[model samples]
Target: MNAFQGRVTAALADPTLKTAIDRTTNTARSKRAAAIAAWPEFAQARELGRDMKDHVIANMEYYLTMFEANAVKTGAKIHWARTGQEACEIVVGICKAAKAKSVTRSKSMLGEEIGLPHALEAAGIERVETDLAEHIIQLAGETPSHIIWPALHKTREQVGELFRAHHTDPGELATVEEMVSSARRNLREKFMAADVGISGANFLIADTGAICTVTNEGNAELTTTPPRVHIVTAGIEKLVPSMVEAMTMLRLLVRSATGAELTQYTTFHAGPKQPGDVDGPEEFHIVLVDAGRTTMLAEGLAEMLRCLRCGACMNHCVVYRQIGGHAYGATYPGPMGSVITPSLDGLETSQDLPRACTLNGQCHEVCPVAIPLPTLIRGWRTKAWVQGYEPLHTAWALRIWEFFALRPVLYQLASNLALRIMPLFAKGGWISKMPLAGGWTRYRDMPIPQGGSFLAQYKKRQAAK
Candidate 1:
């Protein structure tokens, strides 16, 4: 194994990441009732967002074209980046143009997708994450495990301890409020002093060129204001056809993802600080990043773009429950991550990812937009197999299968012979070690041909009928 495999192994070994994944999945599972019980608003929001997402995905090309026009008309400079590296360059150039010394951001996963903070730091500007959870993950030098609540993995006690260790001026660790206050005090200093502010849009409305931001704390407000220049980084798929679509998305977005009637704050900023505005940025920039979306749109993977980042899929995912985000080595993790990341990043960088699942269907059931995750992963598996990414033994097994499958009489004879001999090798109706199947033995048991082959069983049933 190379450094990549070594990194994969190390991330898989990290118990903290696994704990976080479990905490998230468990919370998601238990919160389903609470989320639905507190229905009406949240349910409406989820359905609204889901419908809006589906609508927009169906007409993505039209909406993107419309959004770009409106965004330009609103006096916001628009930069189209086709790749992650291009997005970083676009953002860095904007910061540099404003002569920025430091930048503050409000928890945009797309920023992490493009490694914006690293690029900003590399360009000699300090970029600080202002969201409480994101701030924790950033300070810890880790990628976000959970999407909506980035630091959901860490308990209040853990945060207090982390603050106790890292915060320069702090009080005794007691309540979550105190820890939040400590974070607030520290982040406030950065917000007030920063030259530029960057945020991710929950929804981008084409009708009015609005960037809709939803948040619990007032940090988003401060992060967007108090800076000379502001920028919004978002995937192109985030566009909405109209304000109605945005409102619908917001309705479903809050309820399904975090079970909030309404997020603590929801704001739609149309453009730069208007006249008579007491405090807002003077310059506004929006960078539209495609990364691999354009290509994916043309492929069978387009539906992956329908995701609203609700984090609902990971909540129901078993594979994500066991291993977690860091194990995948991508910005987006869990169910959506499994599909979108590998499609965008390709197999060489993410060969182990699509194989990480057990073909579970929970992700699809809970998805707000109904992405067929298992089918997508299987498609990627087939694609990988064609490219020889699969083990040679697996390839040879497939070849043997094809060989037998092409000859029906020969297959039936071989099948009958195996059925006769299978009982001798079987223990409790399962074969522990199979002759030509390392795949079956690696992680699970293979059931023996208990009664007979499917053909034989079907023939017997037919005869009985």
Candidate 2:
């Protein structure tokens, strides 16, 4: 097996991981359903969100320029990064210029994508993840398993163990409340001591130059407030034209993400502290990272830019439900990852990602922004095949099937013969081990064909008529 297959096998073998993923995802789905049911305008809001995002993506350069102009007017420094490495360098330079020793961070998938934490550590600046889930994963030295739930794969017991091993107190860590309190006590000091704060923006309002952030635990509020220097890192796709459109996106985001009408804290930062302001950052910086987004847009994957990052697609995906996020082994996971990871990371490295899906269309059904995830995934699969990325055996099998499929008489004869012969190897109408399909049969039995093929049954019915 290949590297991707190996990860899938390992994830499948972990029952605990499966249980955690199932429980969390199931709960999220139920909550989302209830929220959607209560909101009669959900469908209309989704359309508006999609239209606004499309408008921004279509005129990305214009909006970005407008945002920078307004943001600079508000006394916020704006920096543009063409790549992930450049983005990291920009953030590191900002910290260095401020002479920052310790930094507190809110959860940013963009930061994780660009390896911001490691960059800060390499520069000898301490980084503290203030988000509860981010803190848990940071303590354990693990990447986030889910986009919204960074430590969704871990159980309460595992978190307690991580705190015991990492936290200074090692206090009683039995219940959820106790663990949360312990984490808060530890992080309170870090927040106070932090010289710089780094955060991700859920939406960047172009007209007003406001950075919109929503968080359930209010960690983002603390992360961005107390620090002397504040840096906001986000992708170019996060731009919305104004507050009205941003609010529309926010409505879709909170409900689809956590099944809440609104997050506990929805904070907006326009710029540095004003003359009369009591408390805020001394300096504010916005780092807009293109990374591979421009390339993706130019190459006809622009619909992906509409992503709100609510993770409803992941929660509803059957394949994602079974394997969880880690099995995909990318920064993002699930249907969205299957489509976008190949584009960002290169198809040669992640060729297996698109093929991991069953194309059940649940992802498309649940997406709040109406992204056609299955179609995008299929596009990646086709691209991979065109680039000769498929294994030799798979190529040969497809070729052989093509040959038979083109010859009607021979195809029918072969199908009839195979149907007659397959049952010989079956016991009690199921084949536990099939020669060519060991991958499927290894995990579950395949039922033998009990009757004639569809074509034959159709022909017989026509004759009767």
TM-scores, one per candidate: 0.84, 0.95
At residue 356, candidate 2 shows an lDDT of: 90
What tens-digit string does per-residue lDDT give for candidate 2 at 1-465? 889999989988896898889879999999999999999998988888888899999899899999999999999999999999999999999999999999999999999988998999999999999999999999999999899998999988899999999887858888989899999999998998899999999999999898899999999989988999999999999999999888888889999999999999999899998999888899999999999999999878999999988989899988888788999989999999998899889999999999998999998887889998889999988888898999998899999999999998889999999899888879887998767878888767888997898789999999999
Highest lDDT: which candidate? 2
Task: Estimate the overall C-alpha local distance difference test score of candidate 2.
Answer: 0.91
Candidate 1 per-residue C-alpha lDDT over 34-86 given as tens digits, one digit per residue, 9 for 90 to 100: 76676656544555666667677788878888888888777787888999899
Clashing pairs in 2: none
Minimal lDDT window, size 10, model 1: 40-49
lDDT of 2 at 135: 98
lDDT of all predictions = 0.80, 0.91
